[model samples]
Target chain A: MTPAVLIEKLQKRYGTVEAVKDVSFQIEPGEIFGLLGPNGAGKTTTLRCLCTLTEPDSGRIEVSGISVTEQPRLARQRLGYVAQEIALDKVLTGRELLQLQAALYHLPRAVISDRIESVLSLLGLQDYADKKTGTYSGGLKKRLDLAAGLLHQPDVLVLDEPTVGLDIESRLAVWDFLRRLREQGTTVLLTSHYLEEVDVLADRVAIIDQGVVIACGKPSELKDRVGGDRITLRIREFAPLEEAEKAKSLLQTIPTVQEVIINSSQGNSLNLVVSPQSDALLTVQKVLQEAGLPTFGIAQSRPSLDDVYLAATGRTLLDAEIAAAGTRDEKAERKKSMR
Target chain B: MSSTMTSTKASLNGKVAVAQTPSSANPVGDFFQETIALTRRLFIQLQRRPSTLIAGIIQPLMWLILFGALFQNAPQGLFGDNVNYGQFLGAGVIVFTAFGGALNAGLPVMFDREFGFLNRLLVAPLSSRYSIVAASAIFITAMSLIQTAAIVAMSAFLGAGLPDALGLGLVALIVLLLVVGVTALSLGLAFSLPGHIELIAVIFVTNLPLLFASTALVPLAFMPIWLQWVATLNPLSYAIEPIRYIYLHDNWSLNSIVMQAPWGQVTLGTALLILLSFAAAVLLSIQPRLRRSLA
Candidate 1:
């Protein structure tokens, strides 16, 4: 079967800023594909190009074998995009909004009502169908947005940060709904910064940073490829920089320790990557003790998705997110998204 | 609910094979369906929050009543033969009201852009994005007609006198022509402008100046020669003069002289032809902008 979505060398630029640079990925049919990235990482831009909302500066984007750039309408017919912002008309009620969406997608007149009803119930939005959307809470609005995106049942559903600004329960509800969609054989592609959300729901993940796809694979496979266990240790509640550096150097000398970095943002805690060994934690404790350092807190865990990102980008996702957030021009972004 | 849900889900799943293909067989049918649905949404919004319509009606009535009263005691023959200032103001008010309404046609579209509601429409498999333009034109024209009716009725009640049925139909046609062009220009601005604030600023700067430059408030003869030239060149004047002629003359034809402009005498037919050309020129000029933005 043709891939559900194919994006090759996708490059998009907003003026001088290259929003997407050399991004490529292919998602199989019926797979839940996640584009995991921090803010300003060009995830939204890639989705926009695929949805034919914004033309890419250079690239090929296809939906189910139809080229989006060459035949946008046909590609659009095969894809349903739920943008990061819920774009419902507040004056329209939930049912009325769905009706409008149905007309937009050109759902058969005979089945429009049935399709609307299915999506409303699928997202548990029946009771609120007749209520104006302005009165809906954040969760209800999101559910209604999901309902709209699913009305025509396109071959693939593309979502951008589907759970942002949602409550935990709503987020979990969305996750469950996406899982059900995949079970029903609808291809799902979503972009998210929430690591666990992608790790838990996505069958395959592409880690995007600074407009580039640095890593892509199943969550477990990517984690295992990083090839180490993570050890986080705090010498004190707020270890001094000098003490943290001393601990980092001492930990680096250990035979099993592959790398050590002092995380200054976390009160100068020491993060270590150690080669897999049953006695890795014991060895770290003993080493600290020998150096007359107190271990206020310590934890050992298998490599997480964040570790995969770190291995690829030389920085934690959180650090990249903070650096991205500081440099983002919100006004320019809003202007770009407006059209 | 659960049973309905289950049946719907089962049916949807059963038809998944067919659903993968495109659903639209008749492009024309799909176009009309989407356009009407979009048009219906605007009407529904107008129905729910009637404040805009309410204010739209009230503002024109105030212009008629207050402006009529302000110039109520003017000398006879100041405007024209056997005409009260109220009679003179009726055509101006009708033309201005419709012009103002059409000028504001972009606000909804601009708001949609700002709120990202337009993105939803853009992402869909619309038969043609021109339907978005059509929906706004239909909605704005409908609104302008309703306001025109209210103003005409109030003007007749205020003793300006109603024109014949044919004359009323002509008035509607003139308003429709003007609205179509202005709405096109406004929608073009909605797409080109960065945001609602900028669109609103353009509307603010252009609104009253266009009204003042036209012959909406006074006759061409009452103005200075340079002002006469300006008023005659204004498209709103073309729309106003024809309606004013039908109101004043009981036996008016398309060839009846409506105004004496500095350059030449313009008959009712010439005025309408001018209005038609103005509307066509504006609509034509904005096509490239609309196509670029919508594309």
Candidate 2:
């Protein structure tokens, strides 16, 4: 079967700035494919190109089988986009907004009402349907936005930063809603900076950084590919250099421990890379106790997507986001998103 | 909490909407449906937050009442007719109000663009993105009509007698032509301008100068030779002069002289043709800009 979405060597630039460069991916049907990256990492730009809101500088983007660039109207029929910022007309009631959306999509008159009703209930927005969107809380607005996007029953629902400013409860609700969407067999493509959000909700993810895809795979597979479990042990809070080195040496002797480094920035904590699924935390505690070094804290876990990002990009996602934050031009970014 | 609130009924029910086969497509019907639906959205907005429309109608009444009082006792035939100052100012107010309304037609679209609502419309598979333009034009025209009726009634009550039925129809046509033309230009700017601030700045600078340069407040004979040339060149004069003639003449025709310019007499037929050409020129000039943005 043809992929639900196929983006090949996608490139887009705004004046002197290259927003999406050499990015490509294919999403299969009925799977939640996530584009994971920090802000300004080309995720929104790639989605804009895919949604036919912006013309790509170069490359191919197809929705199912239709070329989005050449047949945007047809592609648009199959793609429902919910933008990051809620775009509700505050003067319009939610139901009225959905009716307008249905009409815009040219859904048949017979089914528009049913579709609106079903989506409102499905997103748990039935109670708020008659209220003007201006009165809704942030979470309700997002729910209503989701309802509008799903009203026409698109083949792929594309969301940008679905839960960027939503509270934890609303975020979890969105996550659950996405899972149910997958259960009902709709292809979902979303871009998010929240690592756990992607790991918890996405079936397959592509981590994009600085206009390029650094890693792409199942979350667990990407984590495993980056190698080994991590164990962070502090012999004592703010341990001296000699004690940290001693703890690192002691931990390094374990057969399951692959590597150990003293993290000087975090009070000389020892970071260990152990073979996957090993009980290295227990072993490290015993080793430090035997050496008369007090164990203030110790923990071990499987490598996370952050580790995969670190292995691929030499910096964590958080660090990249902070770096991007300092340089983000809100005005230019808004202009690029519109028109 | 949300997961337990409902099952996935949305997908189950969406089959009905999706079963709409591509083979059953109707492009013309789609265009009308989208246009009417989009137009309905603007009206709905007006109904809910009526401050704009309320102010739109009320401001023209203020102009009709206050401006009438401002020059209540000008010399007889000062505005170049057996008509009083209020009679001539009636047409001016009608055309000027519609012109003002139409010139600001792009502000809402600019807001939609800034708020990302335009992207919502753009991303949808409409019959054509021109529906966006069509919707704004229809909404603004309807709004201008309401204002025109209010001004016409106010002028008639103030002793500026109503025109014949055909003459009133001509008045509407004139107002519509001007509104449509100015609306096209405004929407063109909406798409080309970067943001609402820039668009508002352009509207602010364009509004009053065009009004003063036209015969809205004074006849061409009252101006210096330089200003007379400028007023004849202004399109608002083309819209205003014919309506003013229809209001004053009991027997009017397409060839009846409406205004005698420094160069030549502008007949009713020529003025209507000029307004038509102005509308057509604006529609054509804005096409590329609309295509680049909406396409």
Q: Please name the candidate that would achieve the greatest DockQ relative to the true structure.
A: 1
lDDT of 1 by residue, B169-241 (tens): 9999999999988898899899889988899899999889888888888778778888888888888988999
> Any residue pairs clashing in model 2, and if so which?
none
Expressed as tens digits, the lDDT of each residue in A1-339 for candidate 2 is 999999999999999999988899999999999999988999999999999989999999999899999888878988989999899999999999999998898887987888888898899888889999999999999999998888877889999999999999999999999999998888999999999999999999999999999889999999978889988888788999988877777778999998886766578887778888777778877887888889888888888998888788876687788889999998888877777
- Model 2, residue A328: what's the lDDT? 94
**Backbone clashes in model 1, listed as residue pairs:** none
Q: What is candidate 2's DockQ? A: 0.55
Model 1, A1-339: lDDT tens digits are: 899999999999988999999899999999999999899999999999999999999988889899998988888888989999988898999999999998888876787887888788888888999999999999999999988888877779999999999999999999999999998888999999999999999999999999999999999999999988999999999999999988888888888888998877689998899888667789989999999999999999999999999899888888888888889999999988877
lDDT of each: 0.90, 0.89
TM-score of chain A of each: 0.98, 0.90
